[model samples]
Target: MTVGTAGDPVDRSRTVGAVGERRLIVELTRAATADDPSTTADAHDIVIGSGDDAAVIDTAGPAVISTDTAVQGRHFRLDWSDARTVGARAVVQSAADIAAMGGRTTGIVVSIACPSDTTVGTVLDLNAGIVAAAHGLGGRVLGGDLVDADQVVLTVTTLGALDGAEPIVVGGARPGDVLAVTGNMLGASAAGLALLIDAERRGDVELLRRHARLVDAHLLPAPDLGQGPIAARAGAHAMTDISDGLVEELITMAAASGTRLAITSDRIPVGDEIRSAAAALDTDLRDWTVAGGEDHELLAAFPPHAVPSGWTRIGEVLEGTGVLVDGRPAGGLRGWQSFGG
Candidate 1:
């Protein structure tokens, strides 16, 4: 398959020929059996490995499993991001999934597909990013696969241990619960993309870099990983990762819990960097704050008195299904979806 620059297609047939079928099998085998520190941890019992085509972990308590994928162009632009950033972003996104379930990640597996033209050094850098991000979350990548494809696609699966706690699913929320967030709201990464796309149009590379939370946010998502557990310990009724826009995720929580969420736009935190970038781009900060995705913050519902540190009360749960801003139903768009037009 042809892959690389949009207009310049490289011939992959020859490269594939050079590797041949035997080498392909060997690479796949090596990728599958990679070792992970978690596998050797005293708390874990690894029942299977890549050689078996699947992995199994037996922990003392319930396990949490989450998978996330990032595709070039859709999730990130190669021109705008380096390999390390891309890898880190992939790992962080997956880690967020585990946190949403109120679990602490113990291990991860990454699968990557890229073209032959992709540099080996770039791949190594990406792996380094993955390692760094995993370590930040107290986890590690155990195994992964690399294959030739038309585009760069990274898929990460995170495995977590619940540590004897019940899994805080989205359905546990109750009416009258207070809704809160643990991080800044709105366009961090989106603003970064805007700057990169229009450095000349905006004439502010420094400003873009300063506002561009995407590289950092995308690469190293600060998903108050501890916040989820803290909220749970403090009695969170329900929780979810803000992978989609806040409003969008709230709606999901509402649907799952059979209730409605009422949030105040004025209460949502909008950083000055994002606000200025939104103004320059002629976009509404409210829209990005309420609907922009990829922030990876945690949203949880707690009893009025059970607020956790690093979390701000933004709204409340009510007796209905849907989300509202300031007592009125949220108008305009709700939030992002994978297939929404």
Candidate 2:
């Protein structure tokens, strides 16, 4: 019901309203800075930064920048995720955008808004998550803003260096290029979500334990940030990650490339864990593998010969447009969009 520093009045711990915005920001910045130290070069790039009005960053080469946001109920539920998980996920998702562009992420700026009733500990944990994700990926949290809102809302702007390579966009695939994937196959997170939904209905503790891995996957997803750069190095012509659904992102890649992508269902990797979860719910794991989103695996296009090691070939580009699964039109399996099409 409440949280606060030791010896603080019990009533003061009941709500974050007791703390002023300025004080909260000072403490939050310190926590984030401690996790992502200013000793790094990017931190030095800031001529006037955090604690000031804005951030000043200098990049030597081509820079690819991207921003992503996560809203409390829309992106995650407090019941399903703690503040730390939400913060980390918000940062990682934005960083993925940079990686998808074949960039070396240098740093990030995090922006967070939460209701006043939110606890200070929650905010600190959330900042910790953002800092951990960025710093762990060789990126730093340069600065951010904290504001009052009705619910938790997080936005992260990620900055990266192209490192001399051309920024890989989503439309560069050519006919005859190989369609491949780097990182784990799709549906683990969706499967986790499915399990969580089922658990909500059943309230089966044993069942939740049995399917713990899947639930955790949905709660805390770790995107494969390294593969984008690797794919770029291997001469990826086009690339996108499976953030919405595999089918959805593949369609985007196809539309951008002006080519048709043909995928075989059997080729999409489905592990024992996902398969087991699907069976329990009487759901088809294949459906999740094809349509489920948020796995964050790098799906890319490479020349047949240039496809790198560790990249698994899933399909190929053709002369037409759109996506096909096993030569059939993917009418039902599509990625998610914010608004209904």
Question: Largest TM-score belongs to which candidate?
Answer: 2
User: How badly does each model clash, as a count of residue pairs?
Assistant: 1, 2
Cand. 2 Cα-lDDT? 0.78
Tens-digit lDDT track of model 2 for 1-341: 01113232223244557775666667666665665555655565445445556666676777789989899989899888888888888877888888888887788888888898888888877988888888788877778887889999899999998877888999999999999876564688898888777888888656668878777778777766887888898899998877888888888888878999888867887678888888888986666888888877788899999988877889999999878887776643443221123
- Model 1 scores worst on lDDT over the 10 consecutive residues at 1-10
Candidate 2: which stretches are off by over 4 Å? 1-14, 37-49, 332-341
Clashing pairs in 2: 244-293, 248-335
- TM-score (C-alpha, index-matched) for candidate 1: 0.82
TM-score of each model, paired residue for residue: 0.82, 0.90
TM-score of 2: 0.90
* Residue 90 of model 2, lDDT score: 85
